[model samples]
Target: MLDIYEFSAVFPSGTEIYSQNVQHTIRSNRRTLGGSLFFDKLLAQLHVKSVSESRPPSANRGYLYPPSKDGNLEELHDKIVSAEIADHYKQSLLYYLLKDCTALDDEEAAETFAKKSHLSHKYWIVIQGLWNLDHLQFEAALEYLTHPSLLPAFPEDILRVLIDHGKLANKHLPLAYYNAVRPPLTNPDLQKSYVTYLAHLSLIQAYFFIETQPVQDHKSLFELLIDDALQHSRSDGSSNVVDELINLPLTAEQEAWFEEYLLEGKGRTYHAARDTVVARRLALGKYAEAIEAGQQLSGRRFNDINWDGIKDMVATSLGSRVEVDSVFNVAEI
Candidate 1:
C-alpha cells in the first residue's frame, strides 16, 4: 500500500537495510518497547505524492467471466452495456476498464461500449466522452457531453480533453473549439467551474489553428482580430505571429483593448496576457505602457522574453515609432 511506499521514500538510500531493520525490530524481543509503532510513525511521515490509479475488476466482471487483457477488456465492456447486468457497480467497473481500453487503442470496442450509456449513466457518459475524445471522435464527444447531467462533477477534465482534442486536430478546429472551450466561459449552467482561465487559453488556440479570413492589411493583422489572439501570443513557439502582430499600427480599438488588458494585471500574474499586451505596446511606440507592463510582471514572466533588451529597444524607438514601418527586429530583445 501507499504506507509501504512512504517507507521507501524516506529510506531510499538503504531500502533493503531499512526493510531488514524494520523486520528485525518487529521480530526482536523488544515488542514491549513499542518498536513497531515507532518505526511505523517514522515511515508514515514520509508520504510520497501520489496520483490515484484506478484498478480493474480482477474477477466477476459480469454475467460471464472476464476475458484476458485486451479481449477480456472488450468482454467486460459488453456486459457493462447489457441492461440486465449493468444495474449494479458494473457501470463503474466499466469506467475503469475503458481507461485501459483507451490506452490499448481499442477504439472500436470502447466507442461501441460507450454508446450504450449515452442517455443514462453520467459516469459512463464522461468516461465515454474521454474515450471518444482520445479516439478523436469529436462529434461523439460533443454529443456525449450534451447530457447536462454529466457536467458538474468533472468539468475541468471535460474542458481539458476538448481543448487537447482541438489542439491535435486539423480539419475540425472551429467546430471543436466552439463545442469544447466556448461554452464553459459563456454558459450560465457551468458558471461555477474555475476553468474559465483555461477556456481563455483554448479560445486563442482556436484562432491560431483555424479561425481566419481573406488577408486584410496583413495576414497577421487579420489573425490578431480573432478576439482571443492576444490571450496566448507566446503559444506560437517561434512563429513570430506575436511579433508580426506587434509590428502593425494599433487601431484605436486595439490600443484601448491593450490598455484595458494590461490594467487587469494587478501585478506579477496573468503572465501571458501581460506579455501580449507588452509586445503590442512596444510596437505601438507606447514606451510608457511598455515600461509599466514590463515592471508589473513577476521575475518569471519578465524573463519569459528578454525584457532588458526589449526595454532598450523600446526606449530607442520612443519618439520614432520605428517598428511600425519596418520588421521590428526585437527578436534579440
Candidate 2:
C-alpha cells in the first residue's frame, strides 16, 4: 500500500531490516535451489499462480479459488505495468518490489519499467535483462536489451551484451525474422564507422547515415555493416585478423585505431568487440554462455526459436547449468 513518496523516502537501511524480516520468516520454510521457498508460500497464500503453471479450465482450476484470499495479483500486476503508475517509482523501490515479488508474469512490465526509470545513468533494462537471462528466458533478456524505447539511450556495454548473444542465437530462429528486427540503433550517440562516414567528409557522412536504415524483415543493418567492413578491410592489406574475432576478417590494427579515435568507450554502432565475443564463445562450445548472450546480431529473439512447449529446452540441453554472472558477455569486457 506504500505510495511513491513513502517508498522513495524509505532509508537505505530499511533494506537491511526487510532482509532481516525475510530471513526470519523464511528460516523455517523448506528451501529450494532458487531460495524462494517462503516467498512462493506467501504468493500461494495470495492465490497467485506461478508463471510456469499450465493453466486449466476455469471450472476445474484450483487457482481460481484458494482459501479466503482477497489479494488481486491482476490489480498488482496492472499497477506494475501501468505507464502512469507512479512517476517517481524507480531504483530502490523497484529493486525491493522485484525482490519481494518475483512473480512477474508480464514480460512487458519489466521492459516498461526499464524504459521508464527516471535515472539516465542507471541501466534499468540491464537489471531486468540479467534477471531474465539467469532464468533461461533468453528472448525476454534480449527484448530488455534491444527494446525500442531503450535503443536511443543504450550504452556501449549493453550493445556489446546484445552482440555477444545475438550472433549465436541467429540460426535458432526463423529465416524471415533472423534479419528483420533491431533498434534502428543508428542513434546520434553511437559513433559510426570511419570507412562508412569518413568515406566522404562532412554532409555526405550525414547523408549515408540517414539514407540507409536497417530495413524490417531484412538482415540486421549491423550484420550487413560487419560484412561490408570486412570487405573494405581487405584493401587495408593487413592479414592480421584479431585472434578473438578471427571468424570476422576485420583488420585488428584498423578496428583498434577506429575504436580509439571514433568511439568514446567501446564500439558504438559497429563494434568488432561484439564479433569477438560471438566467435570466441561459440568456438569454445560455450552453449550456456552463448545462449545467455541473448540475441544474435540478426535481431532474432530467443522466443522466435520454436520451443513447441518445451519452455527450457536451451537450459535442458545444458543439463540446467546456467552462467554465474548476471550477463555472460559482460565478463570478457
Q: Pick the candidate with the highest lDDT.
A: 1
lDDT of 1 by residue, 1-333 (tens): 111112222112321221333224333412322222222221123221111123432221221121223333334334344424333234444443444334445444334444543424676665555445544556676666666665543344444444444444443543444455444333322221212332344444423432232223223333234233344444644334445445545457645655564465332244455666776676666777666566554434332556545655665766444542232333332
Give the clashing residue pairs of candidate 2, or none: 165-293, 165-295, 166-295, 166-296, 166-297, 167-296, 180-217
Task: Choose the strongest candidate by TM-score.
Answer: 1
- What would the per-residue lDDT of candidate 2 be over residues 1-333, giving only the tens digit for each residue? 233333322222222222334333333222211333322332343344533233542422323112112132333333333433333333423442443334423334333433444433234554555444434345675666455554333233233333334334542321111133333444433324322332222223322443454435122323334444434444553323333123333345434433332233334344343444444444456655555443333332211222211214445556653432222322211
Per-model TM-score, in order, reads 0.30, 0.25
User: After best superposition, candidate 1 residue 10: deviation in angstroms?
Assistant: 49
How many clashes does each candidate structure show, in the order listed? 1, 7
Clashes of 2: 7
